[model samples]
Target chain A: MSKSNNVYKDAFNRCLRLLDETKSLPSEPELGTLLGVSRTTVRSILARMEETGLIDWNKRNKTVLRAPRSEDFFPEEETDSLAEIIERSFMRRLLAGGAEAGMQINELELAREIGVGTTSVREFLIRFSRFGLIEKRRNSHWVLKGFTRAFALELTEIREIFELRSAAAFAALPEDSAVWADLDRLELEHRQLASEIATRFNEFSELDERFHRLIHRASHNRFIVDFYDVIAMIFHYHYQWNKAEERQRNEVAIQEHLAYIAALKSRDPGKVDAACRKHLKSARQTLLTSIPEGRQMQPA
Target chain B: MSKSNNVYKDAFNRCLRLLDETKSLPSEPELGTLLGVSRTTVRSILARMEETGLIDWNKRNKTVLRAPRSEDFFPEEETDSLAEIIERSFMRRLLAGGAEAGMQINELELAREIGVGTTSVREFLIRFSRFGLIEKRRNSHWVLKGFTRAFALELTEIREIFELRSAAAFAALPEDSAVWADLDRLELEHRQLASEIATRFNEFSELDERFHRLIHRASHNRFIVDFYDVIAMIFHYHYQWNKAEERQRNEVAIQEHLAYIAALKSRDPGKVDAACRKHLKSARQTLLTSIPEGRQMQPA
Candidate 1:
């Protein structure tokens, strides 16, 4: 890897962890402290956010922190990259949830803490807020809203719903050029995500999330993504059970993910549908195993 | 109604509308404007909140917003009333989104146009954020995170997970235990909600969401309620399509809701499950009807 690439990866991980820890925006000093990066390097990264065009900050100034409020971050150039945005969005929320309580975090503070900049923190924050987990205050400190039981239940239900939704997207794929290209792109993402999970030793919960997200994106129905996000949320929240409960199921997941990619590569929709179901089932089992007294039928 | 009670209810709706309008915490002036009451009257409401200890206000005697980090506003006692919170939270998100987009708004905002001063909104925000839809900002403005795709998927999946969750809760109820007592308590609330929807009902999408929430509360599980909330978000985001695209399914949903209460009081678990599933299926079908275009096979 190039030296710059290695540095960027390190910066990215630092940002994710800081978000998890603080659930707020981090400032420049905090980023420098966390990533061991100079402010200059951090600012450069923030500047490159022009690619996503998500955050707002004076290009010449160093201190103002702002978020994208419908200013061209909508992905109009529009490749099948919504999946990537979704994936990135999920990571931001996870990190935000894990943020430490009562830590006075600001956009700059978050940027510093996460080794990014005020800009990315603002962009990520806007996206995170869009998902309704992180709320910004009048004074600019981050607070955690946490999840409701209803939301959790709704999220779990999405896995079931996605099966139906993916069926729709799958059917549409043959006739819709956008849908076909979306799957092909997602297949590549799944490969990269899978490789990171297997070879690079990624976080299991995140890897699992990305895997399913790949399926969701392939479904290619806009609502399919929003609609299925909660299921992913349920799975993510109960991820405490992932490594501990699904010890044996890791092998199953590997095969499921691979099967999905192979099918997508082959443009075999049947295989995609079947493999996705199997993957979701395995994911469900992992969640079930984590709960004491697994699910059973009783005449209510 | 007693004058105080009428006043309280009126104030409550005002706050609710404010919550319906803004996702951010309201300033004192905003709250007064939303309530249509003098700033003094709003202060009285805030004082009552502070006195009851349900909310801790900013100690500085400013507009008496929610205490920055107090757990009191979202007391554990109210967790079981999950549906109430879920409804308010969605309303709050809708309000905020509408406000942001500058469209489809009523003149009177809910309570403070910042803080709904309603327990449900607070609880819902906390819970939903935990699940990743609602997030807190640095300045403590509650940001309405977009979980449309994820949330819609959750609503569908939840209809299945909750049947099990509710069934488990029902089984846990001892035959002589006051499950009926709980129902009796919920009866009035349910009727009030149903009547409100039935009377002025215009939008199928909103009515559909309202029905699911009523049933979620009726099931009486805080944990399950939270799960249902995640699902409700799914409904909120996707019900638009389900209503607009699948008119027949919408009609079916209207008919099902027509008798939902009777089915619950029938006191048969299977009946309730069947009813709930049937109700959910109609709604699901409405949503799913649009999904098959991309599906790989004919949906069974």
Candidate 2:
């Protein structure tokens, strides 16, 4: 659910930057490549822009569409939701290649990079400041904060409970709802991903997120959705903590996801519960192993 | 968990305003009455204030030893978490006596009234703006958004599922955990509240929040806790729609909570689940009746 929004925020930010610097809007594939996101994300941003009169986008004319006016530059008021935009930018910074704990984030630099006003960035910084994920200095700069191993352990336990409940809910969902169709598609995708794990192990993170998101949506609860966004932001994006075993762990996770899907499809509550617990336990172990001997445990 | 934070936010905001205007700290009772919160809230705020160098205190000097410096006014940095502070003020106004849907909320006025910077409020507003609970005008003012019956119905369904999961988790918690002690205290409080329902019906709202909060804590998931904050804000506070039946409904709710606590103390998951569903069903009904004939259903 949230991954799609992150794509939009990243794509739109890239578009804004490109428009400012190069005075041109890139094609969908070009924007996707430039932003390192997905073409679907690029399309969503462009579609939203067209809806809001930010651009005159059409399938026949994909290039330019004319530059957005000054009045169209307020990012929070258009395209993605504010939480999505904020989380996307924050996760990107947190998961960026070569990113380190305790890195200082320049507010102005972030505002420019994300193509939002400094005030919008400031608003998000203040929101995240509550979580100790970032702290505003007396000089007004923000510093990235590190999580302790204990934080991760505690987080894993909580995530287990949430996922278990979500799995049970998914199994119990009426077969007639549109959710079943989505789950069918996701299950097929899961099988395909598991089959190609040797070649496409890196794609597991996105698939893992979507697989759990399907179960989460079955509950139709906004609270779970919102809270899962935080969980997804941390676990899905924080894989950079240990890149050495990424492929191996992802291969194991795909197998677990496949079994989990099989159990869910059976519509047996106990089976689904057991499957969720097994996969989540594997996930917890993988998460713990990814953190190197508490080197990242320094308090923020 | 989040309720305690809300208390601090409300109390600290009041104290900051008082110190600025009067140059003197108010006594606990005075502050409580002035802010329309509780003495516990006032004390928590003062304790945090003392810890943060916003004040000085001891058995001998129970009052502020010195006024805070001008730099101490950055609210999100001091006293309470930003989310709590924002939600507390927003819930208060939305559920305030005689407050109506579609009421125009002046940003400057709310900032002054809450004793927080307009920026803090704006940040919070933007977050809630995503939910359509509030809206930002081109002129920068905001308006209170009304929810339809369909919205409430959908929300109630989701809340039911979340609470059901929470109740089961609570029942499964080990007896050795500190949550057991808290549940004992709340159980006794529930009985006491039930005994005085005729005259103390108003107090049920507070007790109801605490009762559910204790179960919510048993899960110990920050996501559940955070999600429950939204639930508590909506259900606990949004009870002013049908004041005429308030006392009668509260009486019924008190009985339900008593049964819920009894079932929980039994350590039987089945009993606990049944009790939770019963109480939550009553809560859902009460919520539906409170909305006055679709008077507040205009989409924001």
For each candidate, what TM-score against the reference? 0.39, 0.59
DockQ metric, candidate 1: 0.06
Q: Write the per-residue lDDT of candidate 1 for residues A1-300, one digit (tens) a residue.
A: 211244444464444334334323456666666776667656655565434443343644333233434442323333223324444544554444443323344666545554454544554455455444456663237665444433334444545655645644554455556655665665566566555554543354566566556557755444456545545554554554234524335545766767766665565667756766777666665554444342221111
| Chain A superposition TM-score per model | 0.42, 0.61
- lDDT (tens digit, per residue) of candidate 2 on B182-277: 888988887887788788888878888888878876665554555566666566556544566778888888888888888988989899999999
- Model 2 sits at an interface RMSD, in angstroms, of 4.4
Residue lDDT tens for model 2, A1-300: 212354466457657657646534667787777876667778887787778765667674544555667555546545565555766876665654334667888878877887667777787776565343665664237777555565577577656766777788788887787877887798788778777877887887888888788787665555455546666767755664556677888887877887888898899988899888998888777677666674663111
lDDT of 1 by residue, B136-172 (tens): 5431256554434343455466466665446435534
| Candidate 2: residue pairs that collide | none
Q: How much is the lDDT of residue A147 in candidate 1?
A: 46
Identify the CAPRI category of the predicted complex in candidate 2.
incorrect
Residue B298's C-alpha lDDT in candidate 1? 18
